[model samples]
Target: MNFFKIKTSWSNAEFILIKLCMASAYILVGSYFHDFFAEYYSILIGIFIITAIWFVYQWLKKMKTHSDLPY
Candidate 1:
């Protein structure tokens, strides 16, 4: 029932890579069905954009935390 729970921790880069892969899959599918489902295709593109933004945010946050650590 706890769908959001992740079984194992992932590094920021790994997590972002996973999200990007999902987004790419969505884009491919959307493009394939563009003629039949323009609205849904737009939705897929929106999701991809959101995912990309999230990846950037996470990557930046990770870098900030690393910079704050004592070397």
Candidate 2:
């Protein structure tokens, strides 16, 4: 029952890049359609921030675990 035991094959850079692309797409679409996105802009931004923070946290945790391993 380990919460942080999940593993990913993608490198940190790739994961971050994908998340950035998604966030950028949302912003771009919102900018293009102000009427539709104005109300949800804050929510979208919040999601992006949360996801970025999660990714960083996971990466840091992974790094810490790896650093502690005997080579």
Using TM-score as the measure, which candidate wins?
2
The digit string of per-residue lDDT tens for model 2 on 1-71 reads 88799876887877898899999998898678999777887999999999999999999999999999999
**Candidate 1 segments whose C-alpha is farther than 4 A from its true place:** 1-39
lDDT of 2: 0.92
RMSD (CA, angstroms), candidate 1: 6.4
Q: What is the lDDT of residue 67 in candidate 1?
A: 98
Pick by lDDT: which candidate is best? Answer: 2
Model 2 residue runs over 4 Å out of place are 1-34
TM-score of 1: 0.48
Candidate 2: count of backbone clashes, pairs at least 3 residues apart or interchain: 0
Candidate 1 per-residue lDDT over residues 2-70, each given as its tens digit? 867858877898889889999999999978987888657778789999999999999999999999999
Worst 10 residues of 1 by lDDT: 33-42
TM-score of each: 0.48, 0.51
